[model samples]
Target: MPAIAVPAFALAWWLACYLISRDPKRATLRWQAAALVSYALGVAAWTMAPGSDTAEILLCVPALCWAGAVVALLPLTPTERRSVDRGALALGAAFLLMIVFLPQAGRLVVLAPLVGGLTLLWRLRAQVTPRMLPAALTVMTVLCTAALGLLLFTSGGARAAIAALGLDLLVAGYLVAVAHAAETGERLRPDLRRALAAGLAVVVLAGIPAAATMFLVPAHDGVAALQFVVLAAGATPAGLGGQVRRLLDRLALADDGPLRSDRAALFLNADALLRRRQHRRLNTVGETEFLRMTRRALHDFADLNRLARSPLTDLPSVERRLAGREDQPRARARELRAVLRESVSALRPPGPFGTTDDWRYYNVLQFCCVLGINPYARRPKTDGMSREARLAADWFRRYVPEAVTKQWIREGAMIVAERLWSEVATRRQELPAGPDGAHDTQPVNG
Candidate 1:
């Protein structure tokens, strides 16, 4: 492999594992991992053994994998999702059989899946895109178009080199972008900015030295060795070092310190809950801005993967649960989510929901936390508040520590988001099924 392909393949593999590890139960990540692995193999065969029977099988598999992954990532109905999945399998089996038995026909048959995948994308253009992600969707469209254009125009060794690399980049970029959109919607802007800067940094630090080795070294294999050495020497300190820092930060957040009043830590500290470093800090953002910021997060809860980070992960209760196993951030997040649900459920009031006497406790959590109802605003949401609710709000305003109230908001929002996301992200039947079991579009086949 070329020195550049080494890093490209390594990154693709690492990112594939990262996405799967986030939530393996999600079919989207599994399909994406399959695509990456197959695409890497397909690129290898295309550049090295384009004429062989084995190479045709290799190309056919990745094309199916790529199309299946795109269908999986979209916010499609479960029936639509399952239909495409099974259809892809059926078609892939037939395509490989043709490649094995009918050599000349199968070479032409392999392109069927790729064209089908592209056509499906064009048809589902409206449904596939998540809100506020038009730019990312546009990038994916260009990649797909470019991959086809590159394969059609290039010929000979140039075709294998350029077209193969284009397909590799296209698959990798599409999956990564989709995975990121799933995690953080608005937060993706800063993440992309950071990624762009890091990519440029790698080019400067690793690419320059590796490029020099091509001319300086005499033997071809010797040059490849030097390129790897130079690339690692540069990447280790600049790239790996930052990853190490974030990893350490994630795993070592277990400070089993006492909570206020010397109680065992059941939730986050005052400062951490308040996001002291960010503008959302209670003291930094006045009551108005605090309400505005919290409102924005609540409004966009469905797009985000997890609740805003809570200090509940540090609870000694959580520590006891993880005593035997390794300290993983993923485990901590799962435990914290469950605990937050139970914690908020305890505050539910008796009787029907309203702004009345019995509803004070639960509604306090509702207004101050989830709704961001600024009672003291110039134009507060107090018109709907009943007399008992108003008095209860005053008591909370006077007695509750501002930071602790902030903590409650964090916990309350976690509960609300968990419920909201269940509705949005659940694989339940959304749009009504059609006569054909929602497989309006069939998987591409020979």
Candidate 2:
């Protein structure tokens, strides 16, 4: 098992690292990463002490991690971290004995969290949309339910196989489903397809040994049977997920655009992620992605890292401004910041600010996204601000729909993009070109 696990662990962990790095602020992704790491560590411990007390103790931890990880993936709205997770910890305690003494009962141990997660899903049914990888989730729900049901007729050993297989199928489908959902603007997690191919490679590496263990090994010992479960969960073999892809061209999470549940988090995770995101992907940004990126840039207002990563920096005005120094992110960042500030200033009305429909866009952008105010917080740090900033903060907390704030950001982005193009046009007109400059050779996008 150790010989086979070495490569599988490396690949899975690599994929885990990539996903977490891409969306460091996503609380859900963080939990998922913890689950994967905990499961892998349990497997490593078991292989080192194939049937020892140490391995048994180590194996117990993954089950707890899974219990929590499954809950974190729940379709939560813009809620705080502690408030949402208290139940998972309580529920984990309820399953403590089974997870400890009957660790070999893989199906039953996994069933607790699976059932708990589904129950939470049921409660949040209103949040479920076809976009959150309904097809893959539907398959997962059916297969795992069926496998657990089979425990009535099957023996204990067979339960291990049933649970192992279910875990294998889910890991692949769930992660891919999450990634696909993210790509479609369904979830806040950065696109998982970034490392999915390597993820599939992990399944291939671990599947053979885990499958062989299921059929040939004696499951009489607790550690041995539990070892296989960890291997299965860790690799997240791609069998059923492969079939899911071929059968239904459906996989994703729901609309996680700023509107989804990000309101509850108030884009807090995104703000954290932006400050850390230094890598710049030079892809063409559509209006929606453009708005999302720009809004995040403002959320991390003083942090040059976010502005440096802004797709708005790709503007010809920005490019022309930088000339040969386009590679300097901070320099580009400075210009992007200037453009954003100008756009925010434009949101100001002709007279003193008032909490009316006319002032909605200004209030939302100025306080929520740009100024980083969270009035709903226990202690809003509005101590030294002007009366208008305070009123705007209160108005945002009381009046604005979380969803509408994102649209305001979109409008703001449009303003900034137009201003950039306007600046470019002005430059094109002013440039004293060479003799044959009759040809309009100015760059459009840059």
Candidate 3:
């Protein structure tokens, strides 16, 4: 049963990795999925190994592979050239060689990866901000390392118990790392928090039957007690870490403007969300709904460019590249229009113009261009617009070409959506809101 179950799990995990890797936008997801595949393969090896000296030595192969997977979870630095898979494989091979040649020093081989991971974590401490998640992961890693260490040196019933608990800790540690990667700086949804809590509750409840089984078999290894304790203890920190961090954020006394770290985190999340949404099929009904969806797509498009400015690598080079690309403004205009057409067509709308707030910017830009009205002409008669909207309109008319202005409106919509998603990063607190609730700041010129 163990043999079958383990390999089945490994296959399922590898399948997921392959499926997720098909999407280019899911970089982080791909990295994680690859790591999971490596880890699963290692587990499968360990489970299938026979009871012999050769088998014992062969176990180190998977052990190092699992360590490589753990190392893959670390965030990449800006200057880092090697991909995570390459790095993981290189490390795995190095560890494999050590264990194979020095069978007597197998325990040291097991310890090597943990030390390397710790060192990487230490070196990356400064790079990882909104530190709570990383800290929790660190604690879990340390605990798993300790458990693995004990499993290596210990014997008898203690060894069996430690092995069980250590495996549990390692699994729990991976969960923590994945969760931390997914929800690092962003606020976790309430349902997710509750789900985590419920999972922990289930772990605790499972301990009862295990303990009863141990009681029935008095001479057996005390695996039940270890199982109960490990499950109960292992889940607490992983679940509590986010809850506590969120609480502290809410209670924080000073409102230091959103940090660079926050912006970077937001950029990552926004990009991922946009990419995912781009691939989704639109299912809106009626012209109004279609226009609304179009507006959303426009906003997403603009936000992508705005957020793209903050690359993980050299910022100046990125900026220069973007600037140089703008030399072909007409080409950009065509591309933007193509994107808009693709998104708008998906909703099967009754033309781009509609009698709704969603059509306001689209109508204004279209009308101005069709009439060949002086680009700078301001319509004071438009009664519904707030001061910010009026200013934006004026800016559009005076300096922006009609096609360019339309593109900006699309981008502006994305900025607005981003603001709605997380006001902390998007809102300029010093600037007052215009009558239409638009911030009175310079419009994004993209």
Candidate 4:
């Protein structure tokens, strides 16, 4: 067989495996037969193509057709999406190898259709499964290996294709695998954490070897190793795992609202509670798309609370007054102590996610959001005693009466303190008590 024919066959084989795995009904035997037929004809045509075989293009045609059919038939699950892209990448690598080994194999005709199909498949499989993705990539790696063999045997023109395809597959595979592990949630299943950790370990181990080869292996030999490392890192998981951690942390603030298993809303019954002022039994909004909207609600609440307080007060000056000098606000802060005392009494110990300090930060952030002042705003570095309290000082100066500005600042400080206290209290309440059960009320800095 001509040098290019080998890659053509390999590409068709990889697609055959990918399609079999993803198609609703595994048509492994049928697709494999079709792929073999196509490769056979393409090789025959290439052998007969005037002086050189341009017939390799035919191998990809049937593969593309089958992939399209599979895409149409399969339900667009996340696993299916990942599978499609991975399979396509593998096929593409095989095709690229053909171009490298056998120079005159009608490059665009072979590559263009392959790339187009892959792009279309990627778009279609947008909601892919973490598991399916790495699996597909594995198939691609095997095809790339065949191409490398061809390169080592061939003398010129095709060497770069061998090096490039090998490296690309190595890197792409690792990245895909890493991402999948990181994205999968440990909390979803007791074993999920172990699975994720194990997957990451594999990538790490694989990465070290691959990375070493990238630098140590000559241009051709090292290419495969380097590509593998790149893939491992890129594919490290993100979506579900990251979101789960965030949800757990937010749940610790359930008393601020309420926490439920449903991820459809952010705070408990926030949507219904926030809308009409009925304020019936407290309902939770769960961790849904509504969380983002709730953040906006917090912003609006601040504006309204500011406006309703002291109608005669100057808006800017009131903000400054509320955020005023510490001493003055501290003295007046005692007035509101009673209002918050009950909430403090109900507080539970901190949970695994945060400590008392973290709770305090959360409340400070909430208070600032409610009052329309950016909590993160920086204080003046050079300004001495007078300008130190930019946040609390400015808020009190603008909103609280001049007589109460000092007290407002103090009250604000108390709010921050209570938040931490309540946060720890809640954490302790969430978990069962015992030596094995940790009641950590620590702050999460990130």
Q: What is the C-alpha lDDT of each candidate?
A: 0.47, 0.52, 0.41, 0.36
Question: Whole-model lDDT, candidate 2?
Answer: 0.52
lDDT of 4: 0.36
Sort order, TM-score high to low: 2, 1, 3, 4
lDDT by residue (tens digit), candidate 1, 1-446: 34444445334444444444334665656666666555545544443444455544554455555555655555444456567778877886777676567654435455566556556665666644443344453455455445434443444443444345444544444544554443332133343344445545765666666656654663465555556555444434342333444445455644633322232122222212222123212221122222333333443333222333322344344556778986544455456445444444566776554544454445556556434455545555677777755765676666655555555555455544344333222222344554656422211111
Better of 1 and 3 by TM-score: 1
**Clashing residue pairs, candidate 2?**
78-264, 78-265, 132-252, 132-253, 132-254, 133-252, 186-256
Q: What TM-score does prediction 3 earn?
A: 0.38
TM-score of each: 0.45, 0.53, 0.38, 0.22
Candidate number that wins on TM-score, 2 or 4: 2
**Of models 2 and 3, which has the larger lDDT?**
2
Candidate 1 clash pair list: none
Clashing pairs in 3: 299-414, 375-397, 386-436
| Model 4 lDDT per residue over 204-303, tens place | 5544454455445534523642343343333232212333444665677565543444432432222212222221101211122112222222233433
Between prediction 1 and prediction 3, which has the larger lDDT? Answer: 1
Clashes of each: 0, 7, 3, 79
Which candidate wins on lDDT? 2
Q: Cα deviation in Å at residue 78, candidate 2?
A: 2.8
